[model samples]
Target: MYEQISHSLLNEILDELQPNAYERRRDLQHFYTRLGANFYAIHNLFERLYGQRDDFELQMQRLVETLVRKYMHRPRELKDLDIAREKDHNWFLSQKWVGMALYSAGFAGNLRNMAAKTPYFQELGINLVHIMPILKCPVGKSDGGYAVSNFREIDERIGTLEDLQTIADEFGKRDILLVLDVVVNHTSDEHEWAQKAIAGDKKYQDYYYIFDNREIPDMYEQSMPEIFPESSPGNFTWNETMQKWVMTVFHNYQWDLNYSNPAVFIEMIDVILFWINQGADIIRLDAVAFLWKKIGTTCQNEREAHLLLQLMKDCCQVVAPGALFIAEAIVAPVEIIKYFGEDAIIAKECEIAYNATFMALLWDAIATQNCKLLTQGLKSLPGKLERATWLNYVRCHDDIGLGYDDNDIRAAGYDPFAHRQFLIDFYTGSYPGSFASGVPFMRNDKTGDARISGSLASLAGLEKAAQSGNEQEIRIAIDKILLLHNLIMAFGGIPLLYYGDEIGTFNDYSYRDDHDKLGDSRWIHRPTIDWQRVELRKRQGTIEYTLFAALKKMIAIRKETTAFADFNNRHLIDTNNEHLFAFMRFDHNRSSKSVLVVSNFSAEPQTLDLQTLAHEGFGTSGQLIDLYSGQQPVIEEGRLPIQPFHFYWLSEY
Candidate 1:
């Protein structure tokens, strides 16, 4: 991108880059200074792809100009943060983080109201908040903001962009991280680019992968999997106005961008930095696995996808050094780990990723009441790089798909295909003895693979038990929820709670009446917070109070323990009690002195052999205090007995 531009303009960009980005000859060189190297590699690739265009270098110059302009516009406070955190780059992989993902409208009705609900985060000890896409999109057709028409503009229904800035500032002052989604994979058919594309402009059409007929699309369909089986049905959509078929992998409205074009990558990089400079401490890269697609493949987790992520990481480091990235890929465990990048050893990609495999495995344990697969699955998970971590959660806004390996299912003594069907049936209450009330989502007719959708409490039997007036069943459900929460908190990473789960919000069947939402079963679990139930918190003898109090107590205790830190160091204890799941969170510096967390999964008392635990460095030289109960556990003759569905964080003298 060599240019004979005036030195005065170059001086302006150099001046801006110098402030936050360290200027060094060799040592302590920032990634920003190395931009020219990235530019060389990218320019060579793009030139090879679009070499005939005379405007290729012109576009390259404009892209660099945009980066310089955005860097200059970045706030002084954020710039200062970049300079300060330049050395200790992996600050995001910390133990203090606890995230909650929510929709701006569903969680609080709007961004302004959501600002007022910061106390909700405080009560739950959450420091990381991921507000699912508040960007503008088409009505009734937006795939929950995945089909974003504009990234900078807030949807008319969700207040203004100023409200989002205010939320970010307030959260920043409180040391809470504000995470926003950057849906770089696609945009709505109504977006300005899409409109230009609809006008039969070849240049605008190049921004997306558009074909005049189904010849190429049908070739892609040969290897690509349909995301939404019942609703969207396919990966390509026909636009009658343009008389072309566009790639819409998730929904018809979301026209997948063509990242093979360098101009598209540069534009998305600007959009990403736009949010980061707007005060976002973290950015969740949504559907990043499908960012780069090629022919003759499923077009997911491709080599080009990894290259794109690397470019993004490099660009972000130049602008917002303090900001972090969480990869949102939910594919199989093997592919999911690649989101961290093979270059993770050098901290080249995302700092955190979703522990979706653990989420799926936990569901497996719930169904089978055994830990064989869960144990084996945990063993199969490769230890993450030093500077990366996992965002552990039980249930999120999306449906839960069984993403485990088929071999793991078979080794657990269940047929892979039949087990998944059983899970969907059990959760949807189609099974005769099922206590759950979930709905089936994305049921693939060819493979019979389907995901289950419901809130944690609803699917854990609380909804049915609460409606049937069965106190014992309800208690058991609450216990199971807490037990699961215990696993997330103790398993050496940040534990994220879905907003409604804290109050046991049930499945809201109200979506069934809405024509737009009726087609998607995931809407069942997208329940708004029941203010009345939330008000019942701290009240005795109520379901809300019981769940809230237990969770609040656990959160308080988790924050106070340094051993709870995540460093990819947790040892599973085969306590020999099938109903009990035991694990030790050992401090890397002090392995001999560690807290032992034991959870009883059954509905009766279970005993742990203290002598067996002592082999893992647990001892009874003095009184053992239970952190959650705030009481000294009674241990006699080297054994600790736990009540049904109870968990203990045992600390010895």
Candidate 2:
């Protein structure tokens, strides 16, 4: 990428990197070195994005200056961390990093109060905490803080900026990683820029896609699919004040930013660096797939979007190298992998992305009571870049979209559309003999596409079992919950536990009474934290105690087991029993140490032939112990017996 003209321009800019007498250029050399290494790529990306603009050189200079200013603002401790991380780039891909995703308001009422629950996280072996978006927004139609009104200000109702800093300081002391959200895709209409645009500010109006009429929006909508057909039906909404149509890919209140505008990109980069300077170890880039738009296309997972992310990563490298970006793009599995960038040994875009495919496949197994689809789905999922990892979770703050590939569905010997409909019916309790008690979200009447909305426990049948007062069903539900937990923990990634899932929190129907929340069924799963109910984790024999204790034990074991590290060394073994799914995890360092994970999805006992598993080097005569129960599995002759809804993390002593 030796562009003579660009290189000369960059050299000239560096020559002009003069500082005032009062300014100390401490670590300015490190910043300059990084800038030199990354500027070529950054310049190329910027030229491609805004080369036609008249102020292209000015914008490039502004981008470079923004990085230097942010680097100066970064704390000394963070700078030291950056140097340490530079030495060990793969530090985050370790087995010890178990994560928990929680809303700051629900977890402990506020930022300062959340510090009191640090011991709770420590006791559960959670070292990474993803605090859901807490930025300032309109109270009622905030879209759960994704519609960020202000990038720098914390939502006062949740806590002040000082409170967040205090909690981050506390977390740092305990070796815990604090993750926050940066809603990079869009902003609330109440945002200052949006307000200015509403007031006929032509400069701010260019920040978003605003049209005088629906002609262009109509063309864009011809290809852009509806995100929330039940609520916001179109991609563009007409603003009465401005008398113009503004592009809003999610909700009308959230205006999509035009990344084509270099100024907007520069502003977002500053916003991201601002959070990193405020002690955020990881910033989740929310809705990254929809960042770039093009007419006659889906406007998702586009090439330009990736270039934007690469530029952001390069800029962050010049500033806070210790901070990492999580690509919050829940797109197709193939597209999701690209978010990690196509680098051979390093991630240039993002270091982590959500394993949405795995989450959907796990739910498919729950619905079908078989592992055929789950196995097929995983086989098709592309392996991510070596330096990047997945944030694997059973459920999050969002509803579960069945985004499975049709090809995988057909490979599992089922009709793609029919199977999806069956899943919806079963989970919503409309199908006969359905055990799940869940609700449907964003049901598109035209396309017949719907997503399931419910807490993990509710979707696993705990709510239905409790309602029926069935002891056997309750036990089965608890086993199912543990079985899913076992897989995610032993899965080749950082397993993120939703806040209340460990305690078997069920769906809260009370959201229906709130006018602001009733429209979004996702609120059903986001119940307020009940401390009184959380105390049940201490009472033996209670469902809460059982789930909490088992998860705690598994989390501890996962931290200790080197075999569970995310090294992309997992190999699936065909048990020939449709109800049983098995995978082998070998230590990346020690070839002799391995763990064979087998889970039965059916409600009946299943058997696996040791002879068949011998192909995977697991048929040896060594004693097979279940790590969860710490007892030898029942083996008759050569077959291992797995109880109904039971999973065994089998390892040899």
Candidate 3:
């Protein structure tokens, strides 16, 4: 990795480092080792980005100094963790790891309060917790705390930095992983840098994509798609204060950082390392797909963006190698795979990514009462690289967009356009006989595109079944909910359970009353955690108890089954039956001990011919037991019978 120019620059920077007599020399040595290891790639990326600048070496020196200072500021315990993780690099890929994503207030009252709720997570068998964005932001203009005014400080409404540290320390004691969000894509207008830019500070103005007029902005807009057409409308906003146009792809308050500037990249890297030093086990890089902008393109998933991530990761490896990065890019399946980097074997960029296409395909199966599309879509998805895993979840704090490709739709025996319209109609309750009660979000009149927003319980028909007091329908609804959970649990990845999904919490219409959250329907699913409803989880045979107990049992079983670990040991079994989807999970250590998972998407009983899966270890006359329910599946002749909306985890006994 040593190059002449880059190596000479590193030596010069090290010599300029005036190490005091008090442990400063040790700090310098640590920085020197890390810089020497990563400088080759860093220098190449930096030079590629800003080689034309007159002061490239000065900027390179600034970048090195930033890393050294952050490394010095990192606490001893986190540094120790970095070393421990380097020894055991694959710790996160274990099947034993289960994650839960929750808001600070929704899970507990604040950061400090979350410490006392550790037992609550334990009860649900969750060890990885993603505490959604809690950084300080301007009131009401926070964009769910993503529009950060300060990166180092926690919001007063949540808790202080000390509280966050305490919570992280407590989690470590119990062997839990704490994930936090770093809004790397943008900053709030109220942020000091943004404010300085608005105040006509020429140096700070370069931090963002600020232009004197629409001449340049309009050119970029031609290829950029509007993210929030209903509310934000366009990709650029005119700042009256500076009399200039600013790139605001998300919201007017959230200004996109100009990553084309090396200084901006350096500043963001410092912020990322700051959070890792704060004890974040995993840093979720928000909105990474739109980092690098260019003319004549969609300004997404650009090649330079990947290089920036690779450089950031390389620098982080020097300081906090234990802390992993999760790419928060929800783009097409092809683009999503690139976030893991194009490396043939190892992932050079993010270690984890969201499996958004699988999520949308599951919903498609539900709406159509057929697994045709799900199977086709999953088969078309490109295989991910080694050393990288997916964050699989049924729901999060955001709406669900139908991102299925048209070719896959046609292959599944459906018109692409009509099927998408059907899914939207079914979820929004506009289609006849649809059980879902979701509301539409960001409906675009130009493209007729929309997303669904509602709680898992509501979308699964629990709310409707309970409201009508239909006992049979309620049982079916509960079964559907459990079926989805079972899939995510047995699936080859970290199963991220959204808060309130365990006890079948319904949607809260109250978000319509809060002016700050009223515009976004995603708040419907992000309801406050009702302890009273959670209490119902203890009452035997109750709806809440049914879901909580079932999910807890499934989680325990998943942890024990090493076959479920993410080592790319999954093989799909085509069941010919359009209503049934099947896959096999092979244990790398004990190859003979594998599990065959099959689920029926139909309301009526469905059957899968056991002989068809013989190649994948399932034979016509073998003794197979359902691990989730601990019962024998009904096998008549050579076909296994699956109950209405039922799923099975079958293991040979």
Q: What is the TM-score of each candidate against the true structure?
A: 0.92, 0.98, 0.97
How much RMSD separates candidate 2 from the native structure?
1.4
Candidate 1 lDDT over 1-653, as tens digits, reads: 44333233344445544444433223234445645434554445445554577876666566666666677677878877777776766566555777888888888888999888898788878888999888998889877677899878889998898999889888978888899999989999899999999998888899999999999999999999888878888899999998889999998889999998778988898999999989988899999999988889999999778778876776676667688888999988888888787864655678788999999888877766667678777777877877778899999989998888888888877888888888889888998888888988888878888899998988999999999999999988998899899889888878998988988989989999998888888888887786767989869999888888888878888877777887666788988877778888776656435778998876679889988866665774666788778788887787899887778987876
- Tens-digit lDDT track of model 2 for 268-328: 9999999999899999999999999999999999899999999899889889889999999
Q: What shift in Å separates residue 296 of candidate 1 from its native position after superposition?
A: 1.3
Report the lDDT tens digits of candidate 3 across residue range 1-653: 88898898888986786655225435445555766787898888788878889988888888888877788888877777877787888888899999999999887888889889999999989999999999999999988888999988899999999999888999999899999999988999999999999999988899999998889999999999999999899999999878899999999999999988888988999999988888899999999999999988999999989988998888898777889999999999989999998788677899999999988898888888898989999998899986899999999998999989999999999998888889899988889998898999999988888999999999989999999999998999898888888888887889999999999988899999999999999889987898888999999979999999999999999998889998888999888889998899998778557899999989999888888877765654568888888988778998889988999899888
TM value for model 3: 0.97
Residue range with the least summed lDDT across 10 consecutive positions in model 2: 14-23
Report, for all candidates in order, the number of backbone clashes: 0, 0, 0
Query: What's the lDDT for all of these models?
Result: 0.81, 0.91, 0.89
Whichever of 1 and 3 has more lDDT, that candidate is 3
* The candidate that achieves the highest TM-score relative to the unseen native structure: 2
* Residue 129 lDDT (model 3): 97
Which pairs of residues clash in candidate 3, taking residues 3 or more apart in a chain or in different chains? none
In terms of lDDT, the poorest run of 10 residues in model 1 is: 22-31
